[model samples]
Target: MADGSNGKPGQGLLGDTENHARVRTTALVIIAFAVVLFMLVQARFLLISLAVAIILFALTSDVIRFIARQRIGRFGVPNWLASIAALVLISTALLVLSSILLAQLNTVLVTTVSYAERAPSAVASLFGWMGEDVETAVFNSLRSVEISGYVRTVAGQAGNLMQGTVLVILFVGFLFAERIWFDTKMTNFFEDEGQAARATKIITSIIHRVNYYLLVKTVVSVITGAMIYVVAQVFGIELALALGILTFILNYIPNIGSIVATGMVALVGYVETGDAQTTGILFLITGAIQFINGNVIDPWMMGRALRLSSFGIIMSLAFWGAVWGIPGMFLSVPIMVMLLVVCSHVPELRKVAVLLSREGLPEDEQELDRLAEEIENRKG
Candidate 1:
């Protein structure tokens, strides 16, 4: 009888362990399937709109809170009212800027088409003078392509811009509403009060980090854009302001953005007057601005915010681009930032977050300052 009791308890313990393992395996399998299903559906446009809305809400919430605190005219503005006002102002500015850029883009496209038409002849003449087989090959390649197809493709993409704009607005409205209820709703999800408080802290930390990242990035992008515009004007490139705005928008993408902007500027230079010398100068100026911003200013401002490795960023870009196209690429870094923030809080995931970070932890101002000074001295 005693032996039977001992055997029964041991069997019970073994059964519990087996059950736990089965549960973990099942949960993992479900999560994997869900991820696969989401990718297969490719609902990227909707996801992008939601992501943009959340980012806009995070960035603007502080301004809204500040306005509410002012107590103007002896009556404080409500949080929602302040949020709406901020949203309206930001939306109006973006709309006006978008319209202007669209007009400029049309002009640039027409100019590009005209240049492409003459490219074959220009290349052939240069090749004839050089008597190089390579030149002949280049001329033949350029001549074989139909430029109209490219023009049509650009035109088709332009049509989609309006739809994307509308979606962004709708998403922004929903995100603002969600911000108001997020804390309360999240707290209610947990049974324990302590758990609720910890969840709130985690969520708040994530929001703060994301907001700071967006603010710094926006400032950096604007500076980069303004510099590009100024350089274009100095170089006498046509549509300098328009090109500057384009540069600002594209610079939101990490790693590959500067290359795209430089190529665009070179194309503008080539199209405006078909002068190779002018094109070369435009490319050089654009590259210089990118070099300064990407190497010096961006790293200083970012200060290990996302902490993503260069290889991680490139991999994320490729993966997201494959899954969601252009919208995916734009969202890739932000998603990575969110993951890093969450991972940093979890014991098992902290190692991954450390690998992603620049120094494997939050920024220490003194250390960063010392590094910056060293870099400056080296340059000098």
Candidate 2:
């Protein structure tokens, strides 16, 4: 029997003890994961606001830095001054956008109440072939729903939304204030300067990818919303504006959003006009629009930037949607991007990144590894 330390083909002195250690480690990991999951569910609102603020900060940080570099009559804008100005601008924009969304959502609720009286019959009409009894039962069941209770619930949620917006503003403000210390902090945390630099590059890459994804998505969503609005108006739908706004908001969610928006348009069309042929035509048109924008334009604009697997996307969507609800759905892809990048950089978690990525490769992992090695060799 040769010694393991000498690189001989023999078991170590501990023998199968290593297997026991692995089992314990796996059990501990599972317990830690369970605890983390519970905390996430409990503190969802705070975490969600923080995540939003982080994203907003990343998107605008470069602009703020550029502004800080300007020399106005030999007086360079200080970093703090640039940060404050950016915070103010962001706060104003957020408030305005929130107000607009609230107004739009309020309109939807009001119309929903009015349409509540009509929706049952409209929906029931589709089931007429199932027998008059079935149609009558559906209409009765729908009519029994308490619109007032729903309104009250939504109104309460609206208050929470306002609070969340304020929290996000505060979170962004703190992030901007802390931006100057980030480099120093990173340097101090890592013993090796090269490692610190690599970490910074990785963070920057994630931010850039997320920012680009958001920009392209916003453009595509706006285009889709406009087309939907025009179609609604042409069809003389009463809730044209509301439908457009909903479409815009929903399109922020990936995979399932476009389908929902298109189906919504078709449903509304059928409900309002009670014409099967008209509804079918409207569905076809909206579906075509969504397919063109979502499938064609969006991919072309994104290119290889978002090389996420379709199955992985759906899984992420399902998990986040279950845990965080609608907001989670909106933030799923960005979260997945962060996960993908982080996992790709970590050797042990590289397999997870492969699973998350489109082609079993998370970005240029080999190139980054090579670059890191070169930097280390140069330093040595």
Each candidate structure's TM-score, on Cα atoms with residue i matched to residue i, is 0.80, 0.90
Backbone clashes per model, in order?
A: 1, 0
Instruction: Evaluate all candidate structures by whole-model CA lDDT and list the values in order.
Output: 0.74, 0.88
Name the 10 consecutive residues with the lowest summed lDDT in model 1.
362-371
Model 1 CA deviation exceeding 4 Å by range = 1-41, 120-131, 362-380
For 1-380, candidate 1 gives per-residue lDDT tens digits of 45354656577667778999999999999999889858645776677766777777777776777777778787899988987888787677657765776787787677668688776766454456567787788788888998888888887777666677778777777777777887677778886777776656555555666776667778888998999899888877777888888898888788788799888887766656567777777788789888888889888988755567777788889887778776677777877777766777677887887876656783333543454455346434
Error of 1 at 341 (Å): 0.5
What CA root-mean-square deviation does each model show from the true structure?
Answer: 7.5, 5.1
What C-alpha lDDT, on a 0 to 100 scale, does residue 114 get in candidate 1? 69
User: What lDDT would candidate 2 get against the real structure?
Assistant: 0.88
Per-residue lDDT tens digits for candidate 2, residues 258-356, read 999999889878878888789989999999999999999999999988789999989999998988888899999999999998898888999999999
